[model samples]
Target: MVENMHERPGAPSAGDGLVRLYGPRFQSDPAAIYREIRREHGPVAPVLLEGDVPAWLVLGYREVHHVTSNPQIFGRDSRRWNAWKDIPADWALRPYAEYQPCSVFTEGEEHRRRGGALSDALAAVDQFELRNQVERIADQLIDTFAESGRADLMAQYALRLPVLAIARLFGLSEADAPSLAADIAASADEGEEAVRAHQRVVARMRRLVEEKQARPGADYPSRLLAHPAGLPPEEIPSDLFLTMGAAQLTTADWMGNTLRLMLTDDRFALNLSGGRRSVGQALNEVLWEETPTQNFVGRWVIQDTRLGGRHIRKGEVVVLGLAAANADSQVRPASYAHASGNQAYMSFSHGLHGCPQPAREIAEAIVQTAIEVLVDRLPDIVLAVPAHELEWRPSVWMRGLIALPAEFSPMYADRPAG
Candidate 1:
């Protein structure tokens, strides 16, 4: 292991080493960072983020899973901690609330009750009625682009469906969905732009909250706002908005990544069960091979305790790289295990404080529906340009193709005279 890693008392076996988050060379290549952490240091390596945000880089799957799952030791409380994160309190509130959910950060019965309530509500979507609604939406999406025979699958097909589907979950009207979704997607990130975007959405959400409180409409948000049925309200709008954003972003990300993988990864999609299962498997591959939320902002070790290798005093931050863990081969049975769903993944996270949705089956179903439609309805479709020329959006914490440029024959309000 590199001497750069420091030692700490009572550290886990994996934590004895020098880990750094800011190196000029590593700044350009995060994959290399993961490689070094796994090959040289233990899966748990001590590091800092963006130069000074102190943390440990747990790049291996087991270590990350353990860290994420243990809320008792590694706290999820943002207010009591994360003051060093330095975003505006209001700006940070939305994303924090979204991931942590209604008392998700807490340990013991509060978490179980809140998580259980959410689970019960979410389970309601699996009913026969919701299935019909989902099927109708899936068919409608394909039909919209079906005549054209050529559509930007991400922009036209994959992106819109999840936004609308989540909107349906909230019982929102289709007419008002576009703006609402747009407003929510912006609150998912952290930075200057994220703060600005959050403020704008906060206003919109505040209006909706007040309106729902007054009128008490049929939407879940309305009922949540009113608490009419003796259900506790979970109206921290920023988080709700980010939940929507997460619902849209990761789904859209998998959609595009799935297409790219199917198109490029040795034609893996063609080998699937009648391509009947491309959506589930491909989506899994996308998460394992290239997750959207690579590094998640997290912190612990306040009041000076040992974490990773180094012993530090008060006010330190820790960032966990979920993507790195997803790709870590050590905890995985093989490099491709997560892609095959053989290993439980950091993609959906684990434990009480994890993502509050029943994301697995629902997301798979959504992806599967799209794949089924594309394979059945648009077989001749192929990438127009050599994929190497296609561009990807590069960010510290996200992985996705920015735009997919390809031409398919005879589609989308742009075909020549018949």
Candidate 2:
């Protein structure tokens, strides 16, 4: 058992056998760690967050599904967590575990009101227009380094595109998009500046809400303002902030991971150009394997319950092992070949709290269009470094490449657009 540095007397401790979710090994190869935990602890394993904070990792597909589906028992409210007293204000993971006024923490009818408004707002998005906007942004991003013949696609393209596109959707002006994008990126990092960055995001969203209220437009924020659900003015910004943060990072990582799969795997690499069919396969494969959201600080146990043959006490934290559940032998495909076209992966999560369908469609449109446009523009692009040399960002919750350096024949910025 790892020493529980934060454990206090009478506070719950998952006795002696908790796997630390942080450290170099978990950062480098989390799948291996998950497998080891599953072998030793079965479907549900006791785990420690950063700072020796104890929690349970649901490692089985069925267990994850059960937990997510039964939110009544495994609530979304993080206030129910028993370890809050042990956590410091500056804890890197606090942004996720702390309670907020957003829809993500709301339960029952409240969630329906907030979440429904968001869904309806998102559903109003013009997919065709969104795709066009994404393509234009992708091309502009590619143009930045196209003439250099080498570029880190992860930073230069994948990371920037989603936020910029989302900014437009929020009705933010062109001048504000870059700053919003940068703030969203910084807020996702587990750094000292994250809290301030998050504050800036909220401020920006609040301003956008005010603008939409005064001058409605055919945009997401405007739609939310007009929704019949009548979400409170103060509550709108929090929800909008949550929506932007969630959509931007997840979609960015989705693009980055899919690109990594295509560049690294021989099956996809062999037929890169004009392989629209292969692109779809790569996207689906990444969701099942390298899903952007690896482990979500998830459902809090509402009461004592037995899950995966282990007794969980009331008010305990239950981390949703999304990547692990996707890799579960019982549900996952034996091989990548068999995994093609299978969309049953819990990458987007499950149950009422699952990512809204409209949001998912918007993310897909952005990811698919961005990838297809890149391939169409630079048909011969290949990794500038060896496939094994690529590094993933050191984050336990999100899975994405640190940088994807690629080289291709030079295309001048002023050259005719593909």
lDDT tens digits, residues 331-376, model 2? 8988878677789999999998999999999999999999998888
**Candidate 2 at 191: error in angstroms?**
3.8
Residues 1-418 of candidate 1 have per-residue lDDT tens digits of: 2112557343322234445444445444567778877676555655644323335566766666666766655666655454445533454333543244344454577656555655554555554554566567777776776666456666666667777877777766676666655554444543445556656765665566666666775555654444323334443464355556667777767777778777666545443344555556667767776776677666454355444454533444445778888776655445553446554668776666667566555665666666666666555567656877656544445555656544445434445887
Compared with the true structure, the alpha-carbon lDDT of candidate 2 equals 0.85
Report the Cα lDDT for residue 248, model 2.
85
Q: Which stretches of candidate 2 lie above 4 Å from their native place? A: 1-17, 270-274, 413-418
Q: After superposition, how far is residue 368 of candidate 1 from its true place, in Å?
A: 1.9
User: Model 2, 73: alpha-carbon shift in Å?
Assistant: 0.4
TM-score of each: 0.78, 0.93
Q: After superposition, how far is residue 17 of candidate 2 from its true place, in Å?
A: 5.3
- The TM-score between candidate 2 and the true structure equals 0.93
After superposition on all C-alphas, the RMSD of every candidate to the true structure, in Å, is 5.4, 4.4
